[model samples]
Target: MTIFAPTTDSHEQQAPPAARRRRRRVGVMSIVMLAFVALCGYLVGGFLRFTEEVNLLAKPAAFAAADGIVVLTGGAWRIDHAIDLLKEGRGRRLLISGVNPDTSVDALARLTDTDRKWFDCCVDIDYAAQNTVGNAEIAGRWAREQGFRDLILVTSDYHMPRSLIEFDRVGNIRSVTPYAVRRDDLWRGDEMPSAPGLRVLASEYVKLVAARFLSTVGIVAKQSVSTRVADLAE
Candidate 1:
């Protein structure tokens, strides 16, 4: 009679601790994988949008004169173009930002073949800017000090969007017109400026994203050594 009776228990068997831990690890790994995939997709989409936006800004248009002009270093033709704009009376003052620490204004003047009077009177060499963020910060200070509300920003074509972003974050200048220096302008002789590969564009796009995120997080980029031009003489 006792053997005939069968009862069902309410509690189910629990998994072993090792098995539970394994399951948790697997879950965590899956979540991490999903997050990584999402991040990659986000970057890819953002890069495509960045490329499209950059294309629109590839060509420089005829712009009205501003209070000042700021040309970021690290490339050719940028200084030349900014100097030409200065000669054209596009801006009252030209600030050459991000000069090398070893460089002197006299050297820059000679390299650009600019008039000494222009360098002395209208052009200011900013050796303090170490990067693009530094460029914006230094340029903003210069603009504020000079009572300049409008400015012409000169940089590479692919770099224009990020440059504008940094300038806007400064929140000082009333107006900023970008003068994008395309790669085509880099060439001097019959040799042409080859189009940058995808890798280069992707690198720039990532930098643009990083710059935006860093600013949003209220993290100002660091600068240790900055160029100071004490000697105005060649």
Candidate 2:
């Protein structure tokens, strides 16, 4: 009787070729998919950065006259612009939300070129909000308390879209006018050039995408307030 014994060595050697082929295919597909995604991201980012709606917020006429001005903190220009509007009589009350607790009102007044009395009476520094969502929450509460029906919302041009979504959640507000700061060009002599570091543009694009997704799921619903006081406090 003749019996043949199976060898493990040949099988082990052959197995590597199959595994290597599968790995190579997967690597190529991953590279292709990554390249496609990167191209799409760049296109979307550029479009959002240059859109008319995004650029309109910086116009002074956008918030010419409103019941109140709500300045979302983060950008240095936002506070300065809000103070200018206050000085120009844009509104009776100004809410500077997302203030640092460590900083005193007097310090803020100096930074904003307004007096402490003005901050004490007309301005309310909100220390609670730490993000855009928090800015809406805190500002909504204060606006309701002050009985402001119409509001002028101030932020960077790129940030206006997401800010609008957050502010819209507060009901009974007649109009949330967006006042965006121009960031694309900082003039140095006669030429206008792209500002170094497009951080705001990039960040706002991400937030805009997230807001769109959230809106689609109905998270950005307009809430109803029986009385302005009731909704603002809640």
Clash totals in order: 0, 2
Query: Where is model 1 poorest over a 10-residue stretch in terms of lDDT?
Result: 4-13
Q: Compare the candidates by TM-score and give the number of the best one.
A: 1
Provide the TM-score for each candidate, comma-separated. 0.80, 0.69
Candidate 2 stretches greater than 4 Å from native: 1-52, 62-64, 184-199, 219-234
Question: Which pairs clash (backbone N, Cα, C closer than 3 Å) in model 2?
Answer: 57-180, 58-180
Residue 99, candidate 2: C-alpha displacement in angstroms = 0.5
Q: What is the C-alpha lDDT of each candidate?
A: 0.79, 0.71
For model 2, the local distance difference test gives 0.71
- How well does candidate 2 match the true structure in TM-score terms? 0.69
- Off-target runs (Cα >4 Å) in candidate 1 are 1-23, 185-196, 224-234
Indicate the residue-level lDDT of 231 in model 2. Answer: 21
